[model samples]
Structure formats: C-alpha cells, structure tokens
Target: SLHNSGLSGHNIKIGIMDTGFDTSHVAFARMRSENRILTTRNFLDGGNDVMGVPGGQRRHGTEVLSVIGGFDEGNLIGTAFGASFVLAKTESLTAEIQAEEDYWVAASEWMESLGVDIISSSLGYIDWYDTTQLNGHTAIITQAADIANQLGVVVVNCAGNEGGNIHWRKVVPPADGDSVIAVGAVNTDGFVSYFSSQGPTADGRIKPDFCALGEQDRVAASDNGGYGFDNGTSFAAPLLAGGIALLLEEHPLWRISDILANLKRASSITNHPNNAQGWGIPNFVNAINMEPYSPQRSLLIITPQPARDSVVFNMIFSSASTAILTVYDLSGAKVQEWDETATEPSTVIKVWDGRNRSNDKVASGIYICVFRVGDNNIRQKLAYFSR
Candidate 1:
C-alpha cells in the first residue's frame, strides 16, 4: 500500500557507488535500454569493465542497485523507479581500503560534477587486507568523510555489520562523517538486527542515524533472474537511499540537511529517540505529506525564538502566490492558520506572533510551520524552549 501514491522518483539523478554492477544482468537490461542509467564509471579500473565475470561472485553491487532502483513485478519493487541512475564502481571483490577509498572519493567528485541528487554507497571500510592500510582512529571521521560532506551531496552509507560484537562495533569512514546518513539494519518487525552496528561515535554522537528493513529483505538476483533475499546494513542503506531519491523528486530544493532533519522528525522515534534506532525508521508517506519538505526552493527560515510570544517567517518561493502557511503543535494539532493569499513577487516575508485568535501565549514546546505553495510544500521546525 506504500506505493499507492504512485509517486515514483521520476527524473531524479541517483548515483550508486559500490562494486562493479552487472549491466548484462536481465534486471538492469530495461534500465539500460530506456537510458534510465545515465552513465557508468569504474574508479576501480579507470576503464569500462563494469560488469563482473559470469559467476555468482562480484555481483554485490548489482544486487544493491536492484534493491534501490530495480523495477520488476511479482517481485520486489525499488523505492524510486522513475529516478535516473549513474553507476560508479568504487569497491571490488577484494574490498581493499586504499584503492577502494580512493575510488569512492573520485566517484563522489564525478557524481557531484554530474549533479547527482543522491549517492547510495553500500560499501564500508573498517578492516583492510593489509593491516598497515587500516584507517586510523581519526581517519574514520576525517579525510574520507569530510570531503564528501563538503560537496553538499547527500551521502548514505551502511553502518558496518559488527553488532553483537565487542570490537569495532561503530560505523566507519563516510558514515562517520557528520553529514552522511549512516544507516543501521532492522527486521520487518522493527527490531534492530543482531548484526546492525551500534554507536555514539568516538566523539559520542548518536549514530546509525536511522534504520531500515535488512533481515531477509528482497532484492534482485543476478542468477535467479528474480528477487532474492539478503541482510546487512549494506542492504538497508540503499533502501533509505532509494527513499531519499523519492523525497528529492518530491521536494527537490531541500538541502541535504533539511531532508535529513525532516526525515528524523517524521521518523518513528520523534517521541523516543535512542542509539538503537537513532531517529527511527523513515516513513516515506509521512515524509511526502509533511510540509516544509517542498521539492523546490532551497531556504527555510523561522524567527522569534520564544515562539511563545510571536514569530516571523521568510522563505524563497519559486513563484509568487504559490504558497500557503499553517502552524501545528508537536502533537499534530493544528493551532493556527495562514490563508493562501497571493504573495507578492520576489522573496516574500510573513509574520506570525505566537498568540492564537484567543490572543494568549502559546505553550512552550516544539511546533510545525508548514508552507504549501502549489504542488511544493515544506515544513520547518519552530521551537519554544521556554514559556
């Protein structure tokens, strides 16, 4: 029933960075024919050998892609069918750190140049074949990660599968980057997976920012010619990545941070956030329905800190008179309304004091400020930390 909205990720560009993808595979044939796959690059070889040899091995990238963008029926469906994709092979069967990490960085730059809306990397680096090549304690949060975040590209990485273990249980590299959305794994029943990584990063920030279904999740298989089952934060990352494409398609102007914040707000844990679930599982429907998530326009501003008094809002609208504004409480209660009046041309600014029609101070807490401008709507957070 989640797909009932029929809001496929049409026209968005998504980059899948992982090991080689088997383009020859039937699951991806349609994508190639329709030009849904914009281009393919292999940072691993610096050549066009994107397809692995005809064996059950080296197909991890293909499987991950199928989960995120594959289109099939009587089988698993991708989160974003209409979105276009760019394939970047940054990992290999060997999973070496130096080469793979270098490949990922280059691939990320290439994706940014192509203006990709999102990058879904099912790859992670913790232990390397060469012990000397291991990323040091600081590298996990620095070099590899910091560069990706600087590009303003939404990067989603899998939290490593080291849960239920005592050593190296946290996420690594790009996932450790403050800007990246590090994903953990959970079962269909919404319980955290035994293999899902845990954290409060080395710096002590809640990690595995969110989770998705990973235990026995469905994905396209290279040999079976149909959907198959798999598990891991690796699989979970793409599901969220695909969902992000849909979110981007629906609200294109959202900055990576805005999209992330709104997702956290709409996640199952808004009422009870913790390390295991971070902000909790993302609800695509709720994400789309929420205002302040408009697909167009890049900036959102809320004013008057003590919203208990009053507040003013300023926003950039794609066109004049295309937006409607409303206010709601944390409990999803509509406390105030702003009619859809024709906004003047150019950047429009509106003002709202915290008092309702009864002209009394609003209670202290969090509030939702929604803007509905034509098909584009966005919701911003307004906080009233004190009475």
Candidate 2:
C-alpha cells in the first residue's frame, strides 16, 4: 500500500532464485527491452540462459520476478519496479521439480558473487529434508541461508503452502532458518490463507516471520502478454521482498539485520508473532519511515561498536543541551527511550545488561541508538553479544 510513497529500488540489485525468468516478459522488458534484467544463470543446465531454457523452464520464476521488479506503469508495477536483477534458474521443471539443496546453495553463492544486496527466493526444500532437520539451524539450505545473512544480504523466502494438509504441519526447510525472513500468505481480507503453512520449527522458533497478500494475487504471465490471478506464499514473499528493496533504496546504509528487525517491529502485530500469520502483515510505508538507523552527525559518541552486557556513550554539546535518548530495534520499536539533559562537557549515557523500557534484557543482536538532539535525530549502531 506504500505505492504512492514514490520509492523505487533504482540502482539496487536483487537476485531472484527460482524456476527461471522469462526474458521475453515485457514486465521485465519494456518496448525497447532495456531495464528488464541484468545477469542470469541456469544452475540446473549449467548454461547462460537464465530466461528458462523453454524445455528447462516454467513460468513460475517469471511471475515471481514480476511481483518484485516488473514494471508496466499503469498496467502493472512491482515493489521495486525499477530495480535491476540477477536471475538464477535454481529450480527445474522436471517431474520432481528436480531441485536439490546443493543447487540452491551454489546459486546463493553465485548471487553473493554478483554482489546482490537482497536475495528473494520463492523456493523451499522439503523433499529431501527430513522432519528432524526442520530446526532453524539444520538443513543444508538453511545453513546456506544463514551464510547469506552473515554476508549482509537480506534473504526472504516463502513459508510453503502446506497448511491445508494434515500430514505436513509446518513450513518447509530453509524457511525454517531463523535468519531468513520466511513469509506466509494472507488474503485481501487480512485472513491467513488456508494453504499457508503453519510453523514452529522443530527447535521451537517462530517460522514465517511475516505474512503478505498472497491469495488470488494479480500476477504477470510469462508470455508477457496478459496478467492473471495467482495464489501462494510465493507471491506474498516477493511482494515483501520488493518492499524491502524499496526500503533499502532509501536507507542504503541500513544493516540487513536492522532491516529484518525493523520489519518485525513495523508489522501489524509488533510482538509475539504466531506461526499462522507470523508478525501479521507489514505496513510498507511504516516500515520505511520507521528505520531509525539512518545516520546523522551529532556530538554523541557510542562506545564499543559491538557491546556485551552493556553500552556506554558520551553526549557532548555546546552549553548544556537537553535531548531524548532512544533505543529502537530494527523494526523501529522503541525498546528503551528516555529524556536526557547533558549539563556537563560529557554527560555519559550507559546501558547495563541491554534492557529495554520494560527492563527486560534484549537478546544478542544489533540495535540502533537514536539521539533526538535539538531539531535533528542522530543515530548510532550498537551490537550485543549475549553473555
């Protein structure tokens, strides 16, 4: 719904890991066919044809890409409608879909090689992943996704459509990865889709970190001629991925971890997400506007880039100055906020045990410190390593 905000990914590069792309799709390529795609690869066939080698392809990837980067002005528009892309044909159209976890891992590394800022994967591995490995840290693909997180590349994935079934009670692998933003599907009515997978990884972490409009979503066809309605968590995931692209466009300096955290904070629920709807739906505009990590210069100095147990900072200003010291999680939630008056040369601010406003200690991760100094908001990064 943030479409009117006028945010576009422009120079940001997003990597699409799915069945493959339809190079001919106008959603990707306009009349002159200029901004449709950038680099592509077919990991399945080991070929340069990422626009799905017809026999080796399916329209799935094309539609997925359309949900993110497709642009046709009034006719259609994706979240990052103008963003560039790197398409990886990691999935096969074979009878079994023929995609193993290794192909996905290799493609992920390839995306990293191309320096993609975000990886939007509508793919999940379930065939070979045993139920025991559904824990957040298990599964080869899950580990690979964590690697992408380590590299600062935001990873988003579908939470699978296995909800309606009794046999499969949770989201598929890779989606179970804690570091990945696993997305579920919701209808326009704000109801969880019947087929959207449920979760709670085997390790007891919330799966499908968020949900998006997925049921009967209007989608671009691979033929590039007409649009049709599609339904699945796949579509929902890309829609959010595109939103993140738009966010990254405005705050290029934002850390991926912050983005992930802010996304949860800005979601409809804001806290205590359930597996059915994850953090509920995200408000795209709120998400972008809530990124408090965007830096501005100030006399405030946050000591210890990476902090453990506590964080100390010095606020220096001409004459005595009064300011608001706030701590916000990635989702822009004010974990801790208080008014401060720096009357001396150095009015030091120290946070012991990383507790928030409620006095509950924050978990080990990244946080943003915002100093509402005078008329400007200056921000600093704080990292916590749990004891």
Candidate 3:
C-alpha cells in the first residue's frame, strides 16, 4: 500500500495510548535511534518510562505498534513506518489490567499538549457502563475524544470487537464519538468479522469510519521477538492510523477534518456506506492521488488492474460498427483478441481472461489493450498479477 503513494508518514507525529510498549522491540529501534520517538510518558504515574508500573507489561501495546511502524523488509513492513511517535502508557495491571475512562481522557489531553497530529487508542473502557451508553456523546472518553478533534487532532479508536455474538452489539466509548475515526475489522475478502463491533450509534449515525484487514492480521509479535499475527479491531486501528499519518504527510496544509472527508470519499465502496463497514476500506492510493472517479464523466474506464485471471473494460460509444479489441504483450505480440458487433450508440462492457488466441495463458506482465471501435481507437494498458 505504501508503494501506491509517495507518502511515507514522514514528519508526522503519532501518539499511541495503550498498555506499556516494549521500547526494546526491534520495530521501534530504528525510529528511536533516529530520534523518531520524541518522548515516552507513563501517564499512570506521570513518569518518563512508558513501560508502566510492574505487572502491566502485556505485549498488546508492542503488537499494536508493530502494525503501524514495524519493519523488516519481506518479513514485515508497517503502514506508517516513517512517522515519529510518542508512546503513552495509560493502562494498569494491578487488578484486571484495564485502562479507565479517566486515564484515556488524560492521555488525550497530554497528547494534545505535544501537538501530535494523530492519536491511536486501541484501548476501550466498559467497567461501569451499560449498552445504553453507546450514544455518541455519553461516555466521558467519547466527549474528550470530540474535544480532541475540535483542537485539530484526529483520534483513531478501535470499534470494540463485540459484534454479532454479543448481546450488546454496538461500538464502544470513544469509537462512538462523532469525530473519532472508529475503525472496524474485516476479513481478507472484505467481510466484516463476526467479532468486529457493529455501528449506527444510539443516535443513528454510523460509528466506524472505515474497515481494514484485522482477522488473523499479521503484526510484529513481541512473543516471537519477531513477526507473527494477532486478531482484533485493536490491530485494525493502528493500521488505519498509519494510513492517516501518510495522508497528513502529503497534505500538510489541510486540517484533519479535510483529510477525513477525502478519505471517506476515496473509500473502496465510496457510493454506498453501511454501519458494518462505514464508508468501507479507504483506498489511500486514490486518496493521495486525488483520483475521485465518476462513472458518468470518464470516457473509457478499465478496472481491476493487476487483476488475476480477468479484467473489465467499460466504454461509451456514440455510434458503432465492428469493434476490434486486442490484448498485446510488451513486445506488441497479440495475445488475446475479441471481435464484437455494436449495432447502436450505447455503452458496452467487455471482460477479458488472460489468454492468447491459441488458447495459451499469457505470462504475467503489463499488457496493452487496444479497442478499435468503428473508426476510433482507444488504447489502455493493464497489468497482470502473477510473476
């Protein structure tokens, strides 16, 4: 995804409020060495050691950080690996190892003091609350989250993983905040995970702003002292936060609200947003490139580039005759050919499976597709996915 845009989150500072982080973790070593981590704070005791007190050493915070900045080439690479960080240990483990609403609010305020551009909280509070408090403005943390947004900081929270199987099936606390970028979890095929919290806050507004791959999501595992996988909306939140950092790097002059609006507009399923997936998965490639495509205005539209097996071409024609469609390899060798008779002025959609006229599969690479429609010819190039 980083290769799809020029943004690497450079010059952006992100604040992560969670359980104690493993400062020794390799995911943060390079950044720390380069002074990427501006500072560390243990909000629990107001100290500089972000590892928290004692038994509070759960590896969850380490895992969360890995999804945003961990890097090891082919082994693992985070979405915002180039961004700076300010780790805050806001969780405690004396009893159940839970972080309270007061602690969360305090962390947000502290992050604000540092003038951080983005804040990611994979932690949620529910000790004394009931399902009815899922309203957008009820929870203390939710209200604080909104205040943070008003102060020009974008807050990213995990839409609690209590969907479908739970009795109280709604997003939690800060995730319900109107301005918070509540992130939900989805499987690889884009289906909402059964455990990802459902949206449409008690006030009837969709909670999660977007969804991302979270089930069995890969991350830098503190357990292996290397790379592994963990599943939760917790993992999803940081992944999205990293994307926001990269977007900020590109549009440094824009406000957080402007960035949010553009991202919602560039969602994979932009036209239709639902409670389960909010706007849908944000296509950062489109967001950074400003490719707000409209089916009506585009002259010729080809889709699913780097497509496997098949590709589709949608073209608008005023009048037509015999349209010759040919797919060619880089060498100008004709691979796949199609001849269609268009009798009138109409829009036509064509699908092509990667193959040659001789019934042989074409090797994976860039292919030039030429559409000779009557007297006009349209040429578009596409890429095939395999090696």
Best by TM-score: 2
Stretches > 4 Å off in candidate 1: 128-137, 140-145, 293-345, 348-387
Give the per-residue Cα lDDT of candidate 3 at 213: 86
Name model 2 segments beyond 4 Å from true: 1-3, 52-56, 97-99, 291-387
Model 3 alpha-carbon drift over 4 Å, by segment: 4-6, 52-56, 93-99, 291-387
Model 1: per-residue lDDT, tens digit, 108-210? 7677656576788887776642212222235542354555454445788887787876766666665666777889999989999998887767666778789
**What is the TM-score of each predicted model, taking all chains together?**
0.73, 0.74, 0.71
Report the error of model 3 at residue 44, Å. Answer: 2.3
TM-score (C-alpha) between model 2 and the true structure: 0.74
Candidate 2 lDDT over 287-368, as tens digits, reads: 7777454333345576665677878767655446678888776556888877777675455555556877788878876666
Q: All candidates' lDDT scores? A: 0.72, 0.78, 0.78
Better of 1 and 3 by TM-score: 1
Return whichever of 1 and 3 wins on lDDT: 3
